[model samples]
Target: MKNVNYINESKEVFDVIVIGSGITGGWAAKEFCEKGFKTLMVERGRVVEHRKDYIAEGKGPWDFPNRTKVDNLLVEEQYKIQKQCYAFHDGTKHFFGNDRDLPYNTKKGTEFSWIRANQLGGKSLLWHRQSYRLSDFDFAANKADGHGNDWPIRYKDLAPWYDYVEKFVGISGNYDNLPQLPNSQFLPPFEMNAPERAFSQQMASDFPDKPVIISRCAHLTEPQKIHVELGRMKCMARNECQKGCSFGAYFSTQSTTLPAAARTGNLHIAPNSVVESLIYDEATNRLKGVRVIDNDNLSQREYFGKLVFLCASTIGSTQILLNSKTNKFKNGLANSSGVLGKYLMDHNYNARTTADIDGFEDEYYIGRRPASLYVPNFHYEPTRYHKNFIRGYALAGGAYREDWQSYGYTDGLGINFKEKLMHPGQWKIGLQAQGEMLANRDNQMTLHATKKDKWGIPQIQFDVSWSDNEKRMMESSVEVASKMFEKAGFKNIQGQATERPPGIAIHEVGTARMGRDAKDSVLNGYNQSHDIPNLFVTDGASFASSAVVNPSLTFMALTARAVDYAVKEVKNRRL
Candidate 1:
């Protein structure tokens, strides 16, 4: 990175300070800087330059000492929580936070896996990349069911932002035209294999309402002028994205927004700056600045800005807000509503079902497809009295021919074994459920009375857990998925539920949620804090509900939109 971009020990007050350089942070920085605002993006970890820092992108299995599997001892000691993530392995372990260094507790008898990727890029380097837009179905879900506070803004409010962000991010998806999952500004969608096409063909006959479509994602299927201008290329279908995509094929902090922000010459980056709290000015009733701790030396410093945008992932941002207890608002800054760290939510993804296919021996896909097939929510019966669950879930999976990893355990010798490994294993269909967890006040996180991290920041104690509504949703999702495959004439079908905790979904969102009322929510319609004029949170922390689809897309859209609004507000001299 240019030295100009790295602002260390700076006393100059910036136009904007964006905390967390993940999805939303990158967008906030990019949007603010491009709009002629001097922005300082604060990251609590080391800088990861794009292309240069993608250390594991092209390595083969032989390159790893343990054949790309993380060492057991290292995993057992430092990655106990991170190992639960699907993408954690030898190739990608460097991007993940060491569990030993980051400690927090959950309530006894309940578990929430708080996966951390505390690097410059944050979880954007480690996300699944499944991007979907939320409709009125999701925005009004709380109001329709009375489960949680109603979202202050609806789908129409975010649609234009989604269009703006998607055009730059390059989403690859079919315009399925489903009301539940609105279409994006799409690149060409990836093709489904023979069996998946067969499954899609038969789904309409079995379940008429549910839309079975190719999952939307942030991968660049076909590079557009905007993407090409940034040196991004088309998706190679490598699917080794968790290791990092140097090609900039997917939307990530490194791949897209960070570079966009850098080119404008208005963005400053502060790596290894752990935010301790927000400095509140009691007399002015605004945030004076941010209190930061150096990640390595434990030295303390402060960064002042006219506006503060908290894009720190759900838990990280909540910690800052809760820890920033001011004399004016004793609990936390902009936390007068007392809802800063309540209503913690994650997708309930504990249900899974897989089945064997008898034939299609000649059929296969090109280069291990990256995207999955999706079954949109089928059980959202608002008018009628239902029994299984209140909210809904979507199932995502695909049929693929297994490689050596699936059958490598079998005993073999010499050339015969080598020849067998070259051949693909039997085809199989796998599906898993991702359901919405209601925003119950009980599912929450609180600052521990005594426990603090090495930087003297209070550790978040998660009291979040799945309720019966989630369990019922899982059961129903599995049944529907199994029946879909069964009706498709697949053989050796096996369907069962899983006993996994929250955060394994890697989509844990909510804590400082957006709502209509100032008394019950932290953020307003434009992601501005309800109490503080210059404070905004645009990451998943501001999510009112954990909608079934992947949330990174919406997080990006909200961040861009929030920055737009904040810039205008500042120009108008209102903030």
Candidate 2:
């Protein structure tokens, strides 16, 4: 187990100080530590040890006191926004951030549900783990459409880094050879059940343009020597991942990167340490250290580092940058471009389509597969773009026969009704569209001038909303998906367009984007600040665009690539 400390003081100026020990921070710490750098990871939440801290792991729904339902009073008071997430349950409520204690403001008319997991692992512990690689189609979307700043780097630049991270993370997938969704270095893929196989074949036969494949995820389907050495095992397919996986089957900070970083014996962790802002030295033209607040007592402390990586969540990192006001950059640190908090984006996941399949009653599957079936974006290719919307969206779902779980919701009274539901019900399939949200400068966030949190940090005020492009894209996805289901001879086909606001996807990005020009973007292609060469922000905050696929895998890839560049530059004394 990684020995983590919750101290308020440190004497040494560390080689690297990684803020936010989540996905990117874990990766940065592991990479930097493995390269022999004295690294310190600061997290605002309690230290949750692997296996020991997964309190609800392996427990059934009936095991919970409230039957996996969070208390209503607590939900109303602290989790009003987080409750919207499907994964928020009694078993996993401890992992979510208490919204009452961590308040933020949104525009009067607009609502953004900032679902957060502000723990030692951040959202890495609660992430869906559906890992996908972005392609050139995603990298060039902004340049082609003229919606946002152009991506400084392209797919080719990050492809090797994706492979490096995938090999260590143990991604389970197939080589689809699709241009829109590139393939990763994959382990043995989890098998498709009977109904899913039938649906995949049928989808291929009916519409070759939209191919259904197994969702690639960061799970150890087949543990490699390295994974085994790390004491991780193959995925048991419990699908109870949100509560935490004691088996270490999934990729999380505790299960994967934290241990690796600790194995180097060069990592020092400060849990319950919330970073207030970065301290910059005007004379040196480099970041001096970070200012931190104790999450429990609100005590202040400082930790200096030669290099700093801000791996906080999109909004959280931007809030830090915006709050770190200085005389040289009066607006905000690295805000000379005046675009630090603009062009916010998240996945538009409000649309859904469901239908009932005819056959496959006798073919039920075993074990709960954590991942669903994936259909990469069929529209918005390099050679073509959707007429209605400039960007595209991906579809993800699975085919499953209703089991005994469905009986719980039905109106049944007698023994016959119980016996009837003992057998499997009809096969049902669903396709939910995760559309691309175009970047809009008007949709932005800023720190409140007067409001402050208990820790003396300014409260973030969000003013982001979906644009017409997102609405059109969602409608187009529903139309395309519903048509596909209808042509497949499915019954009771239903299509829906939701009114749920942005940030629900929890794939927020693009507050501090990367671009070629420092006048417009905050970071360069390497995720280093355009203004401060030694400072980096490699998390979702550095995303130029929120592509159709899940962003975690891309974040890991970017972090690895950026760390490699940053380390080399530091060695050469160029940073």
Candidate 3:
């Protein structure tokens, strides 16, 4: 047994307690500290500084021990769940999670791959950085289909915040006049290669609304004065972003948010502080403080705050609320709606298809671009009709020539194979579909009655799976990809089904959703817990519906908006 010393001393507190130092938490800390609030950020993992901790970011492919190979030991031990991701490897293994240390359960008939990174910067350091905003199509999805509760806020409410964050973060993309995928405040968009440019022109003529455009990524195409002063530089175009960007060219908590917060002189961060639960005061009907377990010394402590921001990832924030059992809220802390752990959703990416293009033998790209082109969703428009599904899917792909890795079956001599691989091969075009998933009551998470983790906390058991709606959407996705390739005059094309389970998209959302009615929602329109005035959840956990677009950009906007409301409420003495 470890030393369980309880340090119940003075109540030295802050104006705000931001839990989990990930993307959203970092934003909350920066906003609150910049607004002159004494903010404390509690992170459950080791602190990793910006340029110094990213040792592997500058390494080349030949410099690695196994030539950037995947280690069998990692696959056997740590990456059983992380293998579902595209960027998991030995060189970047430290950024991912170890499945052995944290374990959860899934229903017997369902499959789920919960990829996580419990670190200082969290998954933001290893994210793809594809920043996009959901349009009115997404905001009105629930009301259109009657799937789940409607989003209390719409695009007009979030558009200003989106612009605010995008300007600071530096998104890069073309300004296409598309309704679904709106353009953002951008730096210079990354240019497409010769073959890719040709494909884009062809697709533009073939399909009207579905224009193929450059990926709107959160990378510094041209670092500004503020970025350079912060020791960040332009992207080197290495495409090894998962190892962590030493140039600070991409937007991570370490590169952008935390540094900004630290400069305010009002931010105090405590890394390796595992938050156990939020302390609720029944007499006051508000959150009083938060209980934390120090990870290094196995000691417990409490910190009081005027406001609490729960930006711990989707499932993590829900677990904290469920563990906070109190007499006032017998079921769970601030779970008056009985929707705390229900309607868990993730974008279904298992319906993707990959194929090879036969032409463009003489064309190739220059440097490694960090993004690919995207084909906007083109299903179930007001004019267009689909027999099976209501919502649609988006397509994103890139053009790449064959490399030396394709010489596995060659019987030729080593030098011959190496020489033959010098020039690029035929251009291969691949497409992946990100389909929207409906919020269902059956897809939920609950605390297990018998299981516990190393920290002696109750483990979470997931009862999540795709329904008939997802199956039909996936079938349509395959057929649509095949038709597009056929129209493009490609040969020997093949479509493969991605074997990923639920939660593998890393876009996990809606465990504690928001709505207008308190009976069906955990949070209000402002992301404040209706049962507890001082508590706010602005992470993906507060989303009422799952949109087809990426959710991180929205999370940033919502966090900024929620902090604004929280600060105002505190000033008014409502919290």
Model 2 TM-score, 2 decimals: 0.98
Rate residue 78 of model 2 by lDDT: 90
lDDT of the candidates, in the order given:
0.88, 0.89, 0.83
lDDT of 1: 0.88
Clashing pairs in 2: none
Judging by lDDT, tell me the better candidate of 2 and 3: 2
Clashes of 2: 0
Candidate 2 global lDDT: 0.89
**Which consecutive 10 residues in model 3 have the weakest lDDT in total?**
1-10
Q: Specify the highest-TM-score model's number.
A: 2
The C-alpha TM-scores of every prediction are 0.98, 0.98, 0.95
Error of 3 at 86 (Å): 1.6
lDDT: the better of candidates 1 and 2: 2
Instruction: Rank the candidate models, highest TM-score first.
Output: 2, 1, 3
Backbone clash count for every predicted candidate, in the order shown: 0, 0, 0
Residue range 234-332, candidate 1, lDDT tens digits: 889998999999899998989889888888889898999999999888888788789999999999999999999999999899889999987777887
Model 1, poorest ten-residue lDDT window? 378-387
- Give the per-residue lDDT of model 2 (tens digit) for 1-575: 75544456897899999999899999999999999999999898888888898899878888988889888998999999889998899989999999999899998999998988888899999989999988998998888878788999889999999989999999999988987888899998888888678778988999898999999999999999989988999999989898888878999999999999988888898888889999999998899899999899888999999999999889989999999999988878988899999989999998899999898766878898987889998875645667777878889998888878877888888888889777988889899999888888888989998999989999999999988888988888889989888888889999998868999999999999999999999999999999988889999999989989999999999999899999999899897
* Candidate 2 segments exceeding 4 Å error: 2-6
Which residue pairs in candidate 3 have backbone atoms (N, alpha carbon, C) closer than 3 angstroms, thus clashing?
none
Per-residue lDDT of candidate 3, residues 63-131 (tens digit): 888877767786778678887687887678787878898889988988888888888889998888998
Best candidate according to lDDT: 2
